[model samples]
Target chain A: MKQEHIQQIGAAVAAVAEKNRINHFYFVACGGSQAFMMPAQYLFDREIETPASIYSSNEFVHRVPKALGQDSVVITCSHSGNTPETVKATEFAREKGATTIALSNVEDSPLWKAAEYPIHYDWGKEADASDLNKGVLYYLIFSVLHAVSPREKYRKGMEAVAGLNDAIEKVKTQYAGIVKEWGKQYKREKLIYTMGSGANYGEAYSFAICLLMEMQWIHSNAIHSGEYFHGPFEVTDYDVPFIMIKGIGATRPLDERAYDFCRKYSEKLMVVDEMEFDMTGIDDQVREYFAPLLAGAVLRSLADEFAYQRGHDLSVRRYMWRMEY
Target chain B: MKQEHIQQIGAAVAAVAEKNRINHFYFVACGGSQAFMMPAQYLFDREIETPASIYSSNEFVHRVPKALGQDSVVITCSHSGNTPETVKATEFAREKGATTIALSNVEDSPLWKAAEYPIHYDWGKEADASDLNKGVLYYLIFSVLHAVSPREKYRKGMEAVAGLNDAIEKVKTQYAGIVKEWGKQYKREKLIYTMGSGANYGEAYSFAICLLMEMQWIHSNAIHSGEYFHGPFEVTDYDVPFIMIKGIGATRPLDERAYDFCRKYSEKLMVVDEMEFDMTGIDDQVREYFAPLLAGAVLRSLADEFAYQRGHDLSVRRYMWRMEY
Candidate 1:
């Protein structure tokens, strides 16, 4: 991965913050862009006036009213930069006189052209690095956004991302072993339910989509861990795999509750707990910020390995129609 | 069925608005309360900048760090008004020196007592109304809210509710007919999918919940109309009931797309389409808005009649739980 691509992301975010002094930020994108924005949105919402609303471009336009204005900076994220809704929204906001920033892997994508000051990720050459490349781009953008937003937050995010990088190798090794061993058990599973809380909820949905659409080619539902109680929990059978994602911090108790319930009710159960990491040296406050990201990043790695081991063709696009939007 | 009860609801809302001179309004509630808030929220989001955010009481503390402040006025809705998180949140906000208004049916419920101002819909003598009572209470609360909020939209709301009342009657008659004819077909179905957009999306969920927990002991899902395209549309076999809510207005186009697609792909498709009575002299806009309220109000009648026709014991609560703070 190009270190320069990461630096550029950080710089662009910093510049936007300096120019707009964005007290309220709205990150508008869809799919992976929305997923990557979740962690930063949570952090920002915790410190400032509600983490900026993250909207899938179409959702922003159709349901949510005019949230962006002169005081707001809208960030449109797209890997290819040609996402129709995002580009349309960028132009729409510009028409209404709102500032815009585009974040993308391709420099000349339509998103970059539509933006006032587009930041290029240009990590196209390192797409093979997969999660590492995508994660770093988001981390750098988040770092700059933190600096621009509740400026008090920049250092904490920097420290958290750095600590995440340090834990990367161990996370990769641990996940590799787990995926290789347990993935076979998923073959006969009738349905898979992936559940998580906070920042990891998006990741759980991503896993649900990939498993049902890409790996198992079966029906899957990803739910907010708490929401399982409302109805879907009753549908669990002995043949279904209940996957619970457990991270660290205050929300850990809720995930623990979900895990306990899954163990009691689901005959086939799996848990990915991140408490094994020795983040005790890190302050509890910083640990709170890093926990979900590290845990989800690790879980994502395991899911990727599991998909490959199960003979799911990573090169093939099973849900190609997702691109029709 | 008591005209006095309906009048009281309208009067209560007007009184609250006049007393507060409320230029802004906030609605906080979870689950059923949140579901009930959907229609009013869409109306407010369209006409005013009084930004509305919905949160589960437990989540309000964590999710809405900076969304609430001293200058703002909050309205918390709970059917029982005893939901733990909402009560605790009301207390927390009061301690933080913010104003709160609670709306509930129970007279002395914790949430009702905790608010700086509380509006209680004591249909104590009229429990038979069930969900219809909730609608009347909402009509009252929205009228009061619109009168006081920045938009002073009470007149428009009263007019809207009156239109809804007319629609409700027509819907009752038509729904009775639909349930007598179609309710028998639903008995053998294992999976039911409810889909809609905007305000109707929330209604779709309520319908699914009623079908599973109240009407039939079956598995059901309420999906946003747009999201069906993501994956669930592939599951449209003869075994599934693809119920689409086709209301008019902003979400009309999206719902139409779903209706058209379902008609082609699914063998068992049911649609509740917008219908209007002859108001030939009325303005086109009024006629337009009238169509949706007419269509949606009728679903209430259909839901109740369907339950009865299916030989489903509406009195036996399959899912029952207590809310604790």
Candidate 2:
């Protein structure tokens, strides 16, 4: 089942990119889909001139643009493919003269039919969809665009993602231990602050949702590491748990400064990086591009097992999409 | 001093919009700027087929696309106009072949000269620049655009803002009491949640900053009220102080629902709105367009007094752009 869930990394991405050749390239996704697109959007912008706008489907459908051309590709991503906003956005995109693409885990889900081309990424209930490795799905969507655009740097991006499977294997056991430890200590946390920079900001939001929204049932804030100094630093008290996502990326310096600043006011700080951990399985110094996905993968284990160990079923929380009005 | 600060509403907006008749618009604002632009961007896009792209100014100068011959207009709005990003964004826009228009309170400041036209309507220090009544600044920026295009709807928008000012006055003092009550009760609270919809989401960030960074020196989280159901509800215990920015416009239904939801988890639920308070001295609400600005004004008073009563000094907690990095 695990092997079945773990996709052929390159082929999955290449397929998505291949299909993207004809569409207008606008995206409506929520949670992980939106999270993963942060890095991919920049990658597409840096390489090809494809301009993809990512919005929460809930917000998009209510305010659908009238100007989308018939040729526009309105791609929607939802792990469950059952999220109301994603389903509505896909439909709305279709209504507004655009072709819809649904990238989801479930086949024949509502979003699947909403899209002109449904790319079923049958991952099953294996791991957190918001995890950056799963973010590979979003990257794969862009990978489809890159294949047709034919750029060297874009191809290099594909090569970078190719190492994901091997990287996953190398870090699995080590992260399992970390997850076990975190699960043990999860309940004692009063407040959690998740910080990331550049591409990692999306992962920070994912962490906020997965742990705070999914696992520990806690309230957490995701602040860009650069903005930490702007105002968020004042709230850093010794008891607060500050989870800093430090990767060897463009945001390394900012993350370092934030970590250092936290040390002054916070004693309970968890740093997630190769340098901070005992890297028994994973290679030391993963490329910055892949670190976000790796960090997300590592965090999934921490949030899931931690919540489970505390006798909390993910669904027991009974998430309600009920409107207040 | 208070009287000198009250600039005529319509003229202020018209002057700034007139000053910034350029091609592309880059808005440099933090909290309030983000709120106003959330809907304003849609207005600009729908009206002229031009989409307004926002950057935190510092981020824009470094990462935005090349700007030569773009014939751009950079409008930087700050309650105080002392924000570092706004200052830097204005200078950066000027360097890259863009005309700068600064809408700020201070008459002679860095941002004033940074722009081709600086519409200075100095609201005294006591009137929080972050407030919507200070719409004098934001209005000027938006109105300038309205004048250039001469849209009947926008002109009607000005009429609507003028009409709302009286409604705003009827609720001012009541909210002051809400702030006082919240501040007193906040001593026992561990965390504060700032919730809003659409433009209110942007304002929520400022509210969090006010409490977390300025006021009680407590940890706070800003969330879209609509998004609370997907997660965050599990963490909504009695220890949380939920602050809701109640909108009276397009998102009124969502805002009202958000307020009701907070009542369940929040030990103290404070709703900042015109209906909830007696707005006697206030007179700036002319259109529904300025609803965010009005809501912000009430929040500013609450945030300011809350911080002062808690013995927190803004000078010490507030971020300085130069020292941030």
Cα-based lDDT for every prediction:
0.60, 0.60
Model 1's chain A TM-score stands at 0.84
Worst 10 residues of 1 chain B by lDDT: B316-325
TM-score of chain A of each: 0.84, 0.80
lDDT of 2 by residue, A1-325 (tens): 1333234334444444545334335667776566765665544433444344556566566445434556466767887778877898888877776766677777788887787766655463454332333544544643665566765555555445455655665666667776687667656665678988765777888788656654567778887776676567767777778788886665576678788888777777777874443333323332555567778777766777756776776555543544432
Error of 1 at A7 (Å): 4.8
For every candidate, C-alpha RMSD to the true structure in Å: 4.5, 5.5
